[model samples]
Target chain A: MPLTSPDRTTGPLMVIGGAEDKLRKRTILKEFVSASGGADARIALIPTASSLGDEVVEVYDALFRRLGAGEVVPVRPQSREEAHDPDLVKAVGEATGVFMTGGNQLKLSAIICGTPLGDAIVEAHERGAVVGGTSAGASIQSSHMVAFGVGGATPKQRMTQVAAGLGLVKSAVIDQHFDQRNRYGRLLMIVAQSPQLLGIGVDEDTCALITVEEDADEVPHEVLRVIGRGSVTIFDPASIVSNAHEAKRSSPLLASGVLLHVLPAGAAYDLTTRTLVPQPAAIDPEDAAELAEAQRDMRQLARDIAAADASPAALRRRLARTRTKIGPNPDPLEGPVS
Target chain B: MPLTSPDRTTGPLMVIGGAEDKLRKRTILKEFVSASGGADARIALIPTASSLGDEVVEVYDALFRRLGAGEVVPVRPQSREEAHDPDLVKAVGEATGVFMTGGNQLKLSAIICGTPLGDAIVEAHERGAVVGGTSAGASIQSSHMVAFGVGGATPKQRMTQVAAGLGLVKSAVIDQHFDQRNRYGRLLMIVAQSPQLLGIGVDEDTCALITVEEDADEVPHEVLRVIGRGSVTIFDPASIVSNAHEAKRSSPLLASGVLLHVLPAGAAYDLTTRTLVPQPAAIDPEDAAELAEAQRDMRQLARDIAAADASPAALRRRLARTRTKIGPNPDPLEGPVS
Candidate 1:
């Protein structure tokens, strides 16, 4: 549909699997800042999911500012009533970027799912403002949220319960702390029962940055690219065979023929076609030109070495001649003969 | 494309995950017999992938005959020249069902790919003859074949190599002995780099029975239904981030954001939409009628029990009255009062 609407430009979404680096490299946060308009960004921090009080907001505020965001404000709504407040809604609406902190996803979904603040966040995305979250924040982006579940590799009946999220990522369920927390079983259980829903599991410190792009056929599709130290795991059960409906209690389910894709940083996936998008060969023209010049020089040097037949005196004489021709600066490509 | 071409019909393909029971229930083999026209079936066995000489062919030949097939023929082509032999091609073309046995996938691909015999198999499939295989046979059904690979849960560089298959299951790569052999990493590694190819892994003693079915929109799509005891695993890497392209020799790869689906027996997946096809609520009309009648009788009996107030003498009297009304026949549902 976005393909047909040429003018419909939605902002990017960053679904961070919890414990993103606030210290050290902070690669995910830096990218978020840049995507949110860098030094011009006006960011709103939603700390409602967190059990921590002002400390969480204070930490993010300091981090965002340190990362060069223009401004940072807090929009914490402790309840549905508080979430409906106009001032809080205004704060999210006015921001160029919105970030939700990790804590309890169920608490976040219960308070934000149907409220005015949630509406504002969606509207902000509609009008092109980057929205991002970690852990609880990440899980709440999908249509079906993993409310709570046991961790294992076996899909079992009633192993997890689902809740409605803001539905930023439609027709999908997101699970955070995937490999580290071993949330594979719960995610598999969710998709086994609801095969129509795509299952996405993000590892800690990793981010699935989703952006809209046009395909070769000129159809607009959402593409997710991984950024961070860890990987993103997706479960596309096109033709699944599971006993999820009948498996009693926590019994292991028979889940067969599930298509599994594991992508690390730099892999891109096309959401519309349910396929992986190929990364373009992306070399800067200047870099390409420089590389070509360097390659040509190396070839020439190799030819000289071959002509000299590896005689130390001959090689030294050739190098000296080449240096003379290049105006006395030792040729970068030609190292001193051993 | 099959959706628009109403007259175009392809045969069902069963990709077995190896070690399907030759004894006991033999559920998968029985289904193959039934699908291949049962009592009137003429089955052809191609044991090209097997290392055992005539034994594999003899075993299948006997099994098919024992299963009540009208005719069983061996059509093994030991070389490209043998594969080109018109007689071998004729055998496969005329059979109602063609089965490939388990062994080396690479050996099978080398002999069959680009050969006249291979073309005949595709032609047979196009003409609506059932085609089935187990293990190596299963892997060789898809467009990209897993020639060889190590088994693990962590994707690494050079974990597996891809060969060409019959391309029966388009845009996919299949692996056999999946969970049992732990081939998850190799499948993941294949998809992580290729991205466009869907990765499918099947567990031992399981079969992915793929058939052509029309959707709600009347569009024809390939649906895979699971059979046997184990599960079928599918990897739909819609948005993957992987370091497959640059990961050094044998180094673990970073594969992120892979969608995984695990379907056990009776689960159906739509290959076209890359989603699960909701199973129709299947109930036999006669069975439903009997169930309804039984439920009504149970309700009446409950009412009678309530009137009797659980008095032993009253209960006995009611049972006597019921039996008398039914002409001395014991009530199927009711036991003696105790």
Candidate 2:
């Protein structure tokens, strides 16, 4: 399992969706450790996405340790001057896993782009270290980062601004807070303008673990999943109807050729083939029944809240506030009860 | 006032900031007509920005007629299928002034990036017809159009994405909704990332009418004054300390090495000299003095509301709501009865 060999497939790179409350954090960490080739893996924690705050790093370190990571080193770059620290670059070069915490992807790219540290991180991934980031970190992994946009399904020109990215994967532009934020429109615009690249929208709390193939003859990578609740939206614009100057008089914002795919939880997508195949429904029926029962319990909780003795107006306000607190959309039973 | 061969400036092309808004509508028809030339300026409207809806040619026609512009033409490309219309190419070739409307700039670029119409637009600008656009139209007037960004003052790598633009002006990247949206950070980032280019942030309800100085043997274009309430921000990055990558270890966000100039109403900045000169302060000193004196009115309003014998909590809530409505930083004189 030596990933250094030219023919060896690199370790899996994981993208964890946000909202890592205590119990959920434990599960995610456990998965991370296992994916990084067992309990003794050396993990590098990048809290740039979380504003390089000490408190966030401490929490991440604690969580990783709880999940049995042998060592968790927090790499905090204080200024552009320190972003080029040789020691930090060396550490990343030898890590078994690199975890980028959530804050701002642009901030992370600002610190690492064109520097020795950025080169080291890319080199580490090439050498098969498991690379992962959440929230903003996930946004930076793609070649084109979704800087900001007015969200929707309408692919208008200039709807989305794309900025420099970490260049972890060049085939697609990655977007975080996908389903929860209604980022479909923004992604579509990105693909329409740059039809050569694909768009991958990762929903909240889900993880897309991409792994390179072992043989050189095959395409470099494939995506594995530990999908949580929502789905991933893939936009492929292999076919495009565009005439550069002819669109001057009419609506150039209207795209004539585009394809979309929504990948639900437990489905695997091959990047090379650009297709989704569901996981075989071969799991024990008893496990399936238990999952169904858990779902039912969650739905009942919603009904109870709605049918409570509170006034209708008060109940409506409460529901709205709760929905906002949880996010645009939330699955009540996806994680363990608090 | 013919904007043809006899009256053309021997200087570089001048791109006015507000093209479609002032020229396509009847708002400043006289000014548009006079600017293009007396009564007979052949005009073409590129409504790429407003392409999602109905063709905006009627607005252009009415505005042009009011402005006394003869032969106002509309070129509509029905689909990506009809992006190549020979008549459209001929119309552009014969036009004295071309106006691009505010819509999706990317759509304009996508359709015209490498087409005959695109070539004609560029050729016309080079041959000396005033080129202009509002918002997205304004964005495409530059060599690169800024799609969008999370407004702030932080300069990070890959924080700005540059799409192929009309290249009418190669000096700067233009951003709309500048001061209104606090987009200083993204603009500064653009200058920092690309030090060679200048960053021009145009505020809403304002325009930068640049004119080529045909008589000047040295500098080509000169910005004319038609100042409104809003201001423009210019970011010059030639003096920045761009070791942004070195700052990655401590924090990814770097806010260093950007020179900003806020050009207020009635003020003009010489791009060549990079100096701001006031135009005798257009606001009447007496009016400004009266406005300053009105600060006492705000306090009086607050006290009056407080003394009205209302419930203290209710009164407090009302005051907070009013203040919020007025904005965090509002001109004290801009309240009720002002």
Candidate 3:
């Protein structure tokens, strides 16, 4: 007895893991453009994580237009007042594809959850519209979303705090910047607390396109995935050792489990069957060539950064300052010593 | 905070789903007669499903000897063979309690999974002792235990399977003879597809006694109940649902995603948390008095059937056939037809 009828969206979802500079951006754009079944499809870019300065929006608009999107809409919801704008919601509703850019996921959730715009996004997804989110955007698709955590292999109790997120996917809790950041420990800790949810660690430059089809009988939907490089590491706890109700701030994290599959690009993972297999290579040769060109452009950017006319010390200092500005700051008063 | 120290096993485990007649015989006896503390703390029993069988096991060996228990064990396997010998790898290593009892539970996970003797039951659980099973022998302890679905819920595509059990509690699945013949739809569907295991369903007038530590991290270890009145229903779905890769079956009837809970004689519910609470009022004072009187009868012989006779017609027929059979029926064609 199938739970629902099969429904397919006209466009495909594209999720990028992060570190999307000029080259990476071009590659993602090309993929999106081609997946939309021609350049005529309307595309809506949600850059909620960025400050949305005029220059950034203009640059994105130009880039998307050059990539063949007939019309590109940059959604900049700066304040709570604009977060629920009806016009923006309608634009997303009417668009063929919706893209979420990298930034702070917490901020996005804070501004979107329970709002009309949020409802519209969910509705569009259910209607089979192509919806994609990068970095933090990817992490927000689970019920028990990770706010942040220290990286390590040891499981510590209460090391991770879960917050509400967009309820798009239920089978797994996703973490971005996987291998690059050594986030396996954090993912394991999460599964220890809630063994029901599978842990999906998506590395930078990787994407997981989850497709859901209602069972023929329509009780609950079944989820399928098209996985791409680098790899998606799955953390499945064999047995849980932590207690939720009695856990305190000082509990040691302890979990014993298994890592079932670490699927690479061109792989398909079936949630219904809990299995992974090779997916038919679907990217066109032309599109693949374009992607390679975009990679070259990214390498050029990195080379330029390395060759900049500055002392190594100065460059390190500048990078640290930039990180502080973009990332979360620790509370000064809570420091270990004066 | 950490719930328990890594050095010691946390609190005792208790199962309370079946009545008194459906529990396994050997499990009950061991749990009731074991010595308290030290190695005896690792005592455990796997009751097929019921409290009566557990009680009988206690009194079977000696009329007046007081039994001190370190632990009470419950063995609810995915198949019968899994339940019978049980891979004692974990139990023997650490259990202080161990017991096995008689409800179907797909014949105790077909003698337990991954086993020389269900590795989880005899070896892992026995290391700590205090193990027992009752009425499905306290189903819901195993990771792959069973849960019955009634009340018009159909098995649709991805609607969640309604047989055998959820494997989380232990690795075994469980079903109870709940509300007499009402379990017909619940039991048959569960065992249709996933038949590599056992199905335990306890009938009325039986119980399996599993013991846990008195306190774990300051919180007392209480009996975890999987109770059901009348009859317990068990279904193993490994056989009915074909495993053909390309050929899709309509609502494969396997014992995956089964439902199991202890609906004891009580009415306490946690609406906010969506959890069950104990109902003290449901325990009849008269029954307690009768139990005391029954304890006085030192020479009573344990009978196969209870006088109350609350089992469903279908289960009664199955149990009768199984008892009369002398050898294995080699013709696979003679198995139950969907």
Off by over 4 Å in 1: A1-187, A190-245, A248-338, B1-7, B216-218, B241-243, B281-338
Q: What is the DockQ of each candidate?
A: 0.18, 0.01, 0.02
Where's the lowest-lDDT run of ten residues in candidate 2 chain A?
A: A243-252
Using DockQ as the measure, name the better of candidate 1 and candidate 3: 1
Residue A312 lDDT in candidate 2: 71
| lDDT string, candidate 2, A1-338, tens digits | 11122224456677665554446545555777777656778888888767548998888888888777888888777566677898888778878988888887778888876788777777788788888888887888788888777654334456678987777766679987775565655676677678788788777766777775533565354654545544455666676433222222212233333444445445566665555543454445666686676787688667757666656777677668877886654454673323
Q: Estimate each model's TM-score.
A: 0.54, 0.42, 0.40
- Which 10-residue span in candidate 3 chain A carries the lowest summed lDDT? A1-10
Model 2 DockQ class: incorrect
- lDDT value for candidate 1? 0.83
Question: What's the lDDT for residue A126 in model 1?
Answer: 82
Candidate 1 lDDT, B165-190, residue by residue in tens: 99988889999887567676788889
Worst 10 residues of 2 chain B by lDDT: B1-10
Q: Write the per-residue lDDT of candidate 2 for residues B1-338, one digit (tens) a residue.
A: 11122123522332334432443343434555556664778877777667653446777677777667877777555444445678988888887777776677777777766788888887877687656566777788777778766653333445557777877656678887664555644665566567677788776655655554432455343553334334455666665444443322222232233444445444455555444543442445666776665767677667757766766777667667867886554556564234
Report, in order, each candidate's fnat: 0.36, 0.00, 0.00
Sorted by TM-score (best first), the order is 1, 2, 3
Recovered share of real interface contacts in candidate 1: 0.36
